[model samples]
Target chain A: MKSKITRIIILLSYSFVNLYLIVTKKILKYVHPKIIPIIVISIIIMSIASMILILNIKIENHNKSKKNMYIIFIIPIAMILFIPFKQSECLNTNFTVTQNISIDNKEFESAGKQSISNNDVMNSKEIDINEVIENNKLDEKIKELILENDVIVVTDNNFVKWMDELYENKIYENKEIQITGFAYKESNFSKSEFVIARYIMVCCAAHMAVGGLMCNYMADDIQQDSWYNISGTIKYETYDGETLPIIKVNKAVETETPSVEYVYPY
Target chain B: MYKNKAKNTTLHNLTLIIITLSFGYLLGHLIVYIGFDQVSRTVKIFSTKFTSIIIEALPFLLIGSFISSLLHVFVPIDTLVKIFPENKFTGTLFAVVAGVFVPLCDCAIIPIAMRLIKKEVPVHIAITFMLAAPIVNPISIMSTLFAFSGKTNIAIIRVLFGIIISISVGFLFSLLVKNKEIINDKNYCSHCTINLNNTVWDKINELFLHTSEEFFNIGKYVITGIFISTIFQMMFDSIGLNNISISNNHALLLMLLFAFCISACSNSDAFIARGLMNSFPFGSIIGFLVFGPMLDLKNILVLNKYFKRHVLIIFTITLVLLTYTIVSIAFF
Candidate 1:
């Protein structure tokens, strides 16, 4: 008689959990995009199985071991019930590029021209001469020397989007943008076009999504997956029903690869 | 002799019932105190923490579980025994390879491997299969590929490392724990015996029973692991660990601690690893995947139930060392 009551309680508990999961999944759909389908399916399957198990208990002959099975089932549900004890708000900080620049508006306009006007300023600091030439401000021969020595090239879809956004916002329009990412080129495509790519992960690398920015350059000049820091102007184009953005290369240079190549800014 | 045996059996049965009743009461009390509102909140938190893990791992778990059930229901024990070399050295090799093909996850594999061990499958082979099957199966392989975005090299490295570790550990275990007396002597067909006279129905019953049992066993582990991990996640959120500089490789350290505490199943660890990647490293993430399936809090409890203390100690040490080595080499 004691065992019969225990069995009924176990069955009811299991049924409640199964019903709870189904309802919870429905509630979660508004909060998280990916989990709704998985939750609904899991609840349905678990509920059906629990119902079958409960019905089986009713017909099966009295067995002492059935109690043990109920114990196993309850432990997990009990553990799950402990989740609210630790629930708290997640901290979210938005680090924007506009926040990084400390320079006043007066200093910004003069800094670029002053650096360009003085020969001492030009010679003392590392400046890409090719950029001056590309902007039609310097000689082509000086630009060639600059292109031959120092410039980093990035070619990946995500990097391209990042660069496009950075350019559209005028964050690095007249200034230098230093980027480190992988180099990729599609075969049978244009020889002058390549991409710098990096994988963006949300939680673990398992859900890592690839992002890169496109760069127009000779394929022979850049190796795949090579790290680079290119200083260039960002440009935009439209292709295949999407607006495309890219960096117009003034100079390209190779650099030592970082030990950890992937970086998720978010 | 029959009377004495019956008396001992009755005593054991009574003890088991008492344990179950006490555990059930504790569980009922926990549910009631937490109340329906809190219960729903906990479930929501747990489901969120584990949703990604389950999504990433479910396909592999299903495939691996199905394959394992198929092997159990269809393959003859003698046929499996014949495939391996009789010598321990070569037998361990066959064991590791067999582990890769078997679909059983960490917890469910224990019973199936024990069954194989009783049927004259070499102890080393069974041990290797038991250790490696959860980490090296086709479903795990597919999930890893999809998780890493077809990074074939990393997937290959994981499989190779798993094989090497499982084989070596299996061989070591066979030498250390040679006593047959330590193994469970219960009938493999205890649950299936009721419908045995009808072969077709019996086979169907066995398959259904085995699958259901396997699902419940592993599912419980997953649910528990997810709950603990969620708590940890909440703690991390409260402390503002998410905003910390993960780029410095400290994310791996945090995830290792999290994996140890949560003790998630290997098949589902990838999803947890995925969510963690935003804060951890590829190497430390792999460590969680390799180690959690082999040695976790829940599996440890299950292990303690069957294996002697001394054997469990050796197994735990070897598994931890191998996991550390494999993950270090891959990430460092």
Candidate 2:
């Protein structure tokens, strides 16, 4: 009982919403960069599909009860295209740095055995981060940069790997460190101290976890959602029975938030 | 008279669309601007996270629909049957292996698997494809590899357990539903049944037609699914699951249920599991990785569209129990 053109309009909307996201680059906020290639492929496919649909039209019959199905697409498509919402950086709930990891050698060895046993069927060795970053993720540029400058300056590119270097701060104990992250304060923390952190997006914003070094600063001007540049010396101390690095800030200054807030591993 | 009638309906539809869109737009602005201090933040998170899932899976759904449409138009049903072994055991086994190669996520696999069922392919074979396709694909395995970088055992165990659970569940269906009615109505369309007289161009036209049709058809279910799962995501956020502590077995059970509720795509579910792995035991994170793809809030609703009510009930129970028993025995 419906015109075939009605269905064509719905189908073309499919192509439009996808195309709108890709062209606007609004999709970057939701998905990881690696997903873009497949999205482009899909856009191309949808274009051809809608083009063909426009060319070939017919008066198709349908039950009147089926009309409500068309309404389901409206709200989501509109929300996607028009809504002024961003995934908040306040997603510190799913993330907790302290963990009970099984570091004992017994469980580690058995885990290795079981991996090999199951992977015999696969016969493929997936290149993990360790393999790609052979030298503990310290590439020549970073190493040279560290050697040249007394202070180790971390950019967005090296933020994740360099922060990871905090776990073993043997080499960089006395090295002056400069980094930038948003201010995160816990109610239990001392008034002069807070965690300077940025969200480390694993696959997308949905899976982002906060990663940053703790800063012991005596500043009262720190604001939420504002970026801060902290220059300090790497100070290692035992906290909660574990040796951890805390930045002893000599200077802390508020700065404008960067264009891209979330950092991805890829 | 006919032309005028058609014209009026078209105008009516356009007016209807404008009203709905304007209403939706105003509603969105209201949610963002007009709200309680905490209410706005929850809504903000819900919208962004909900879209991330839909946008992330959109490409796969598009490609899956295209490939499935190609099969519907170009490939004959006989070819689909002949490609698989006629024997039940071999057919089910082959389907599970074939599932690993197809590389569609749980959401994308539904249309293909249901189409196979409609084409009179064995229910067990199609069911196997639906259950196992997402868990062992190349992209998923690579993601798992990266997520559990130092501990590759979790990645391998996920794939291993996925295949085992898939085969067992497929066999379970074969035994339980053999010689029983799965689909009550068999009056689905097959205009191309007389494609013998159609040209290649005609077949290609049919291909695009099916593609467009399938996109919208599957989309309704997908959007509905996204809505339900987002609601659940917001609920969990409010309840605050992080502070609670339970026994080892209870944690595993909770994780399985969480996987079903969140309805994350299989490829990205590994990353979510990684975040939780720091808190939960290694086995429960693996349970989240394994149980999620086989069944979820979204796919279960979509599955209801093609399957009978009782069939879905048993299917869900079988998958959950099989996944729980296998994962606990293997990892715990």
Worst 10 residues of 1 chain B by lDDT: B184-193
RMSD of each: 15.8, 8.1
Residue pairs in candidate 2 whose N, alpha carbon or C atoms collide under 3 angstroms: none
Off by over 4 Å in 1: A1-63, A66-266, B1-44, B50-77, B85-90, B99-111, B146-152, B179-198, B206-225, B236-256, B264-286, B305-309, B325-332
Q: In candidate 2 chain B, what residue range of length 10 has the lowest lDDT sum? A: B183-192
lDDT for model 1 comes to 0.49
Fraction of native A-B contacts kept, per candidate:
0.01, 0.35
Which lDDT tens digits does candidate 2 get at residues A85-156?
Answer: 554433433321111111221111112112222222222334465345534434542463453377778777
Worst 10 residues of 2 chain A by lDDT: A97-106
lDDT per residue for candidate 1 within A1-266, as digits (tens), equals 34444544643564465456546652322112333354445444434444444445554433333344455446544644543322121001111001101122111111111121122212222345533533452232233222223332333323423432332233333343445665655453366666555544333212223445557654367875566666565565443333344566666778776544444322
